[model samples]
Target: MASTRIGRHVKAPRATVYRLLLDADAVARWQVPTGMTSQVHEFDPREGGAFRISLTYDEPTDTGKTTAQTDTFHGRFVRLVPDAQVVEVVEFETDDPAVTGEMTITIDLADADGGTRISAVHDGLPDGVSLEDNELGWRISLGKLAALAETGELP
Candidate 1:
C-alpha cells in the first residue's frame, strides 16, 4: 500500500492544536484542501467513533472519482490520545475501483519550541492517487490548521 507522511509546526500550544483536531466545527473550517469547502455531517471524537465529511470543489463542474463535484468519506476513530495522537481508518465513498480501499491516517502532536509540532502519516493510499498531490493537499490543509490554531482565524 502507498503512504504519505508530512509534518508542520504550528504557532500554537499542543493542547490547542489537539483540541482543534477533534473539534468538528474547526475541522469544517480547515480540514479541506485549498480551493475546496467542507461540511461535516457527523463527528465523534472517541475511540471507535464514526465521522463523515464531505469536501466539495469550489467549481461546480469539478468531478472526482467518488462523485460529481464532491468527495465524501466516512471513518472510524481507531485511537485517540489526549493532546498527543489520533489514528483513524478512513474509507472514501467512491465507485472507482482504483480508488477503493481503506486509508489509515495518524496524526501525532508534540510540544516543541513553544508550539505544537504535527506529524501526519497516511497509509494505504489508493493506487490512482499521486503522492505529490496528496502531500500538497495535506500541506495546504495543515497550513489552514496552523492559521486557525494560531490566530483563531481561517485563511
Candidate 2:
C-alpha cells in the first residue's frame, strides 16, 4: 500500500474551515478543476455518515471533441472532532474491480498566525495509483478550500 500526506496553512479560522468541509454545496463548489464540474451524490458530515463525489473532467481535444470522464468515490466518516479534525475511510470504484482499496483520510486543523494550519494524510492508497496526481489534486482542493473560507467564493 502507498500513503500520501499534504499540508497547507490557510488564512481562515478553524471553525470556518470545518464548516466548509461539512457543507456539501460548498464542497461541490471547490472540489474540481477550475473549469470542470463536480456533483455530490451523497453527503453526511457526521461520524459514521457516508459521502460520495462525482468529478467530471471536461477538456476540449484537438480533434474538436471533448474528453470527459467521471470518477465516483464512496466513503464514510470514521471520526469527527468539531473544528479540529476528521477521519474518513474511503474506497474508489471503477469498471476494473482490481483497482480497489481502502484509504483512511485524516484532516487536521490548528490555529496559525494568519489563519489555520491544515494537514491531510491519505493512507492505505493502492499501489497502482499515482501519488503525484493525488498530491496535486489535494493541493488544488485545499487551495480552493482556503479561498472559500476566506472569500466565500470558489477558486
Top model number, TM-score: 1
What is the per-residue lDDT of model 2 for residues 6-111, given as tens digits with 9 covering 90 to 100? 9988888999999988899998986675545788999998999999987776664311111236667889999999999989998876645444778899999999
Clashing pairs in 2: none
Q: Would you give me the overall lDDT of model 2?
A: 0.82
Per-residue alpha-carbon lDDT of candidate 1 for residues 1-101, written as tens digits (9 for 90 to 100):
69999999999998999999899999998899977889999999999999999999998877776778888999999999999999999988998888889
lDDT of 1 at 144: 92
Output the worst ten-in-a-row residue range by lDDT, candidate 1.
60-69
Error of 1 at 50 (Å): 0.1
lDDT of each: 0.92, 0.82
Query: Which regions in candidate 2 have their CA more than 4 angstroms from the true location?
Result: 60-68
Would you estimate the TM-scores of all the predictions?
A: 0.97, 0.89
For residue 153, model 2's alpha carbon misses the true position, in angstroms, by 1.2
Native-to-model Cα distance after best TM-score fit, residue 5 in candidate 2, in Å? 1.0
In Å, residue 74's CA in model 1 sits off its true spot by 0.4
Q: Per-residue error at 130 for model 1, in Å?
A: 1.6
